[model samples]
Target chain A: MFSGAQVSLYPMTDDFVGVILKAITALEPYRPDFRIETDDVSTLLVGPPDQLFPAMRDLFVTAAGSGVHCVLAATVSRGCPGEPDDPICTPINDVHYGQPLEERIAAAIQQVEAAPKTGQIVAAQFSLYPLGSGHHMDEIYGCIEFLKNSGVFDRSKNFCTKLRGDAGAVFATLSEAFLRFGAPQGHVALDLKVSANSPTAV
Target chain B: MFSGAQVSLYPMTDDFVGVILKAITALEPYRPDFRIETDDVSTLLVGPPDQLFPAMRDLFVTAAGSGVHCVLAATVSRGCPGEPDDPICTPINDVHYGQPLEERIAAAIQQVEAAPKTGQIVAAQFSLYPLGSGHHMDEIYGCIEFLKNSGVFDRSKNFCTKLRGDAGAVFATLSEAFLRFGAPQGHVALDLKVSANSPTAV
Candidate 1:
């Protein structure tokens, strides 16, 4: 079963996708069985882990050559994003790889909680590109709604409460989320901070 | 005399550029005098900083709301990337930002001589990206040529005989070279490393 992979390319511009596409194709020699489907700026590849890992390695090496920088979100298990009706038979969730606003927030919170410090707020911030490509406001609203209803966080809290727990638990949750939304070669920056409430130079 | 303000928006896909344009135009109320241009995935806005700041602020706010995460790079300079015919009113060689890369390196070495730890190279790495549009191999050879001619790094006898500077410095140099080549938004992300040899993180 295939999971999700999220990738990011720096100097993100029009021709970056071409470079990413080229990198994916180059990986075919390494992971011949995986299917690669690209739509606009995002791409999805589904296959067994053994094949997928090599494919990803080839992608990184080739992208680096093209001045591309990428981050793989995680390996997924079920669902993949493709054409709406022609959904690819992959194990990654389409919603997570695309405009994964809600899942990202949840993952951020989970990551922070997993590694809480004396005066640190474990937090993650994410950016998305949903202005075009038929992304509707309703779908975004639904994601927000689902997040609110997921009961993962208490909405009634005065401020977003900091969840305290083991890093393993937090990581597991984040890993699960990554499985759903990670893409092959898109730009996503994940900063794990143990910043104090008041600023102090590191 | 408007100190030109430059705004570069990078979208993951060309299709997303249209919506980004709409968001930028929506900021017309905030920056009425803003002049905008699009050549590929980058949208360059040149105008007065007073008006440009708010326009940029508005555009980022809307983009965030729309789920498009962006990494913004800006500068307020005396000249704009206005037109091809316009002679650069600002002197090209002024070290307005900082000493030339070579000068900076020399100063660092001298300072390190006084205090050995100052020049102690902590880390060093180098990377390149194509200039302008980045669809094809850019003549980054010019940057390589600059580094070679500048006598910046002592190829021998130095504890850290390598390029280790801030990511910003590296990019700025590369960007300047591309501009000299008459390529707008044709740039690449430089993979760099920092050392105690330099002042900032590479």
Candidate 2:
């Protein structure tokens, strides 16, 4: 079982570079338990459930607190039959492999900070897989019901719901959903993504 | 902003009661900030993102570390046009609301501990909503790609993927996906769920 996620953030302000840097930097504290990698498209976090969730929560919360509209997109996966039994998939209780997570993340963020600022807003897409549990569709429906009852889901749209206003609130909602659906009975995996923004000026 | 998540854990072992009790008790330290509520169905933690996420992380890690197969289902949401500005939704920086989370969680866990043990595995369903962003379909695609590449997505199924094996690995993957997609740009929401089981005799 290999667990990992790729995350992309789009900050809707001139200081977008700063916001992204701050978000990535926040994960530095969790370096002891996580292995983080960043490329041009997204940043990847690999580690145990305990460390990974808390680190991600902290990262997103820090980024959202910048008081600017932004969107964070990610895709998480585990229990793939196809995954290779390499060092990267080693259990958390074992010795770590590869470069230190904090240094890698810091270097990546620095590069982003130094890059020329882009005034344009970013829009990206994401998905999750292996949402199987023999009754995946049912579980998906149940998850939808749970979200609807939570009061954060707007039913006005066709496939996606609108999460408006505060960034903290949005992150909270997303965190809950991911934790619940991660390891379902009968071995289920999921695919999901979002495009978020502050309310546009009316 | 107020951030919160409602989690329900179903352990597929005879010691289900103990597992749930231990997980809830794990959050006692964060009583200062969270408002925790538990019924027969789920435990809801509402507060600042900082407190809520850390608390949930601790709880799940403790439960998963027990080495029993369990399914933890949750739904998270925030900032919807339909949500009432009740005390539960109050910002973390504001005055307190309701009873203390620690006391409530303790009482609930105690009740579970006292209940007669049911030696049956639990199967449940959950859903999340407000996954509305005009381009939700695209985000879904992105999430799928990320999961596929993560090496844990079980593509054996037609519509969903299967995440099996260690609870920690499954949790790590799900947590990453939820945190990322929960708040995408253009105001998107999500829906998902899971079911898990301990390793059966070969």
TM-score against native, each model: 0.26, 0.38
List residue ranges in candidate 1 displaced over 4 A.
A1-120, A123-202, B1-182, B186-193, B197-202
Candidate 2 per-residue C-alpha lDDT over A11-49 given as tens digits, one digit per residue, 9 for 90 to 100 = 545455678788888888877666676643346676653
Shift of residue B153 alpha carbon in model 1, Å: 6.2
**What's the i-RMS of each model?**
19.4, 20.6
Alpha-carbon RMSD of each model: 18.9, 21.6
State the lDDT at A173 in candidate 2. 44
Interface RMSD of 1: 19.4
Which 10 residues in a row give candidate 2 chain A its minimum summed lDDT?
A: A121-130
Candidate 2: TM-score? 0.38
DockQ of each: 0.06, 0.02
Give each model's whole-structure lDDT. 0.33, 0.44
What's candidate 2's DockQ score?
0.02
Q: Lowest summed lDDT over 10 consecutive residues: which window, candidate 1 chain B?
A: B191-200
Cand. 2 Cα-lDDT: 0.44
Candidate 1 lDDT over B60-143, as tens digits, reads: 444434433343333323221222322322233332224444444344333323321212122222323221222222233344
Maximum-lDDT candidate: 2
